[model samples]
Target: MRRFIDSEADFIFVLAANVASIQAEQDAIGFDAPDAKYPHKNAEGLCSFAVLVQEKFSDNPILMKMARIVQAADFKDQLDDHPAARGLQLISGGFPIVTSNDHETAERAGFLYDALYASIKDNVGL
Candidate 1:
């Protein structure tokens, strides 16, 4: 089923929540000095995406809520414990404007987002 957020405030909250979730993972796993680079890169990418979404659809609550959900998942730490988790994290992280309730949900959500993104890009001549 397609879940929708309906408001920009909700989207911001989702984004914050997902970011917080990621921070939680960082806290739990304790990355080494060398590993720190990738995490920082990931975070920067997320921030950039969020900025783009905010700029492109300032009034779309669905997009905002999706962002908040991504921020809330805490995928980093979860992945540290399970190999499968890493794939899910990458997928979800790639599309922060989508919401997933749990691991399975995350996978499905990622698939949906991937298809949607692909379709959009294809249709846009990108």
Candidate 2:
């Protein structure tokens, strides 16, 4: 998972320096390398991606909420104390079961994040 995070940071750094640098990639999507050769699940990639999103959208509550889930899921074993994090971890477990193809899984995950963001974006005072 850590390895995935490192690689994602590298990717984000490059993307930030390139196409996504001038304007915020507000439409940025998250992804998990489902079949990574790594020993454990690649939750770290999503975690890293969340970090990028947090940096880009500092005022976005929806993305921030999603980031909490990503952060929690990545560190769930040792640092997850929030109920939302725990629930996200459990829900994410099913993502792998939904599809074996990484691209499809990523697309689905993106949609899930979009829906999550949409669901929370309109609440006045949650």
The alpha-carbon root-mean-square deviation between model 1 and the true structure, to one decimal in Å, is 15.5
Cα RMSD to native, each candidate? 15.5, 10.5
Local distance difference test, each candidate? 0.43, 0.53
Give the distance in Å from residue 59's predicted Cα in candidate 1 to where it truly belongs.
Answer: 21
Strongest candidate by lDDT: 2
Instruction: State TM-scores per candidate.
Output: 0.29, 0.54
Cα lDDT of model 2 overall?
Answer: 0.53
Error of 2 at 11 (Å): 11
Instruction: Write model 1 residue lDDT over 1-126, tens digit each, in one string.
Output: 123333222211123325555445645221211243223225444433344456566675555544443433343543354333355466656654554444455456647655654544565455
Residue pairs clashing in model 2 are: none
Over 4 Å off, model 2? 1-46, 124-126
The local lDDT score (0 to 100) that residue 104 gets in candidate 1 is 53
lDDT over C-alpha atoms for residue 75 of model 2: 68
